[model samples]
Target: MHNDPSNENGILHSWQQNAEAWTNTVRDGLIESRRLVTDRAIVDAVLDGQPRSVLDLGCGEGWLVRALATRGIQAVGVDAVPALIARASERGGEFQVASYEDIAAGRLPLRVDALVCNFALLGKESAERLVASLPSLLSEDGRFVVQTVHPLVACGEQAYVDGWRQEGWTGFGTAFPSPAPWYFRTLASWVGLFAETGWHLCEMREPLHPETGRPASVIFILQRH
Candidate 1:
């Protein structure tokens, strides 16, 4: 498999070593916390009983995949880390241990009605490669929905304290502490990425807190042309 120097051995090795504990912590936290608005919006948009097949990319621990399956959608989850895939499979979701680049090369066995990527695609080159592959992975008119750390937060241009708040979650608590090169762009950048990848941008939303009404995330929906 081709490897990018920025995302090579160290990052993967770190995740592999700590994957079990990391996945459990993440899973427990998400299960207890209230749903993020962006997550709800993504689910509302695509879980309309139409798209039977769905692929959850970078599906760590498969929470979203299981949620989709509970709604009767045929969902499969895939991630590069072996431990994460093992946990996902234990949850009754089909999980594959492979990167998006690997899957794009025909490593996976099935295509789907839609693709969902949730806070999973980071790093500039990797995101670009995955965005470039979405069109071919979907059925005609297939939809793609993604939730990511808002560009402002990820880029360090905007702080999480300014809007959405996570009290105890330290930014650098992950197994990998150093930041990888991330492409956290404004709306135009997102549109451009989809356009360059041959997918048409359909809708965009900046989800906000229900009470404070402060912007928390940006969600994008794209349709295969």
Candidate 2:
């Protein structure tokens, strides 16, 4: 319904304005299923010995934070939207309204055991900067987990026009409707980004769709080197 195609910032503002409704709709349908498998995989990879501190970047509505808390980890959620932050705070985790770039500028107040970034970080520049800043925020041996739309699928080259039918969800979601260029990098590019940024790649897994059982995503787990 929102169609402002200026830049990444503009797209983000649009999301902020419509995020609650959009995310709720997503959660009630396809995203909720994908998240269950993705979140569990990330938690299993990073949450060891009841980590006392964790950080969720681009935390929308604090779902990840609340999930971590239920596992006994002290989690904090950060996002750029005030409405999302407010909703996140009411769910029991500490919420901060701050951009990822702003958070990267200053040292994190605590050495977090893990940092999880879900299907957030859409902008190329911001994603690069956040990826580069992870080493400083994570404790030694800490893990950084990320799950995003597969570049091969999101880029204009390949279209999943009919795959959604097989996967049981309507494929009406736009990959990049706005002019803000998304960094749909290949697997090598993704690995190189972290390697150049001082993080050691540990594991990379692509999960299959629940319905079609076809590979639908690429998930990465990295550790500070």
Candidate 3:
């Protein structure tokens, strides 16, 4: 499959195809990474900023939106995949079907106090374009928080570089198929991308897993002064 997200078999297409299975997997607690560590890590990171309104970019099934709602924080979930957004809407969240292209083009009408992208940035060009377009979508004091698989740990045997990586639905079940290849970015690249887009890295959190004590994900809290 082509590494570009615009391709028919790219990351967005794969998510659209497997939205149901992905929703089930998430709701069922089948993935140990989210079940144990990353999910709460992201939720807590978002809440810590105390934003009244939050935008969950690439939010799947609106889980985070629903979670934040319990605490009286208004949240909206947006994704490029219509199926995922539809599933999220069915779950009673404020969701809209909007691609990164749509967002980058300033189609989003509201500016949010906080924006969260949890393991959702998959393509190289999309990531950069999306980040570059975020300042206008955020309030003056808004924060952009992103949580991704720790690059150092996730790299494994692959050479450390920014390129297309063969996706491994590692430890996932047979129900999930046609896993799409994702762009692999180094930690430095992540920081560089943010910096180049006028975002200052305020805090970086590596939440540890209880069992292995390994950093499960890296959370970057970015701010613009």
Candidate 4:
């Protein structure tokens, strides 16, 4: 019951506070179901693109960076939370403490062959800005891939509409910091955002959970026109 929308830095502060726990959970394979299914789907699509390098935007603990590097693909990670960025740096990947806002302003300092965001696109405002900047961040044939909680699956009992909702953080433990504010956009809204932001939706996929046979997340592959 500690929700405070007035705190502009709430999301960043929460991640900063929960960085160690978050890193540990991810590295320990706490969400292994996602790592095995959703992550594999994304990595497969990324490799199919055959990019020389990639930008792992909002990369929490650098897992994707390391994964791509193992394939002989260079990847750089960027996160707003310094604590997370520090942890990612320790994992032997190039990382920077840059916010999505900085990336929107063309300050990434490097253009990548591809950009991937894994369950990291949070707020609608920030997401729109980042989408607007994708053209500049990617090479001509570069593709942008995003894997996130499916609106249908994540909405649960809540109304399937565009708005902010709190993440459960169940796997991270109750001791974890404030739940991050996630913007819920319907499937149509997601498609609309891509169209309005100048991206062509090349393909879409739904990664299903092995046991439940329900979508674990939605993946979108987009490109600039």
Best by TM-score: 3
Better of 1 and 3 by lDDT: 3
Candidate 3 Cα misplacement greater than 4 A, ranges: 1-9
For residue 140, what is the lDDT in candidate 4? 90
- lDDT tens readout by residue for model 4, 118-225: 988887778888988889888897899988888998889978888877775886533576676667889999999999999999999998898889898999999998
Write down the lDDT that model 1 would get.
Answer: 0.68
lDDT of 3 at 15: 81
lDDT for each residue of candidate 1 in 165-212, tens digit (9 for 90 to 100): 211234423443232333345656667878888877788777776765
- The local distance difference test score of each candidate is 0.68, 0.68, 0.87, 0.85
Ranking 2 against 4 by TM-score, winner = 4
186-205, model 2: which lDDT tens digit per residue? Answer: 66777888898888888887
Q: What lDDT score goes with residue 208 in model 4?
A: 89
lDDT, candidate 2, residue 23? 51
User: Residue pairs in steric clash, candidate 3?
Assistant: none
Instruction: Report how far off residue 189 is in candidate 4 (Å).
Output: 0.7
CA shift of 118, model 4, Å:
0.7
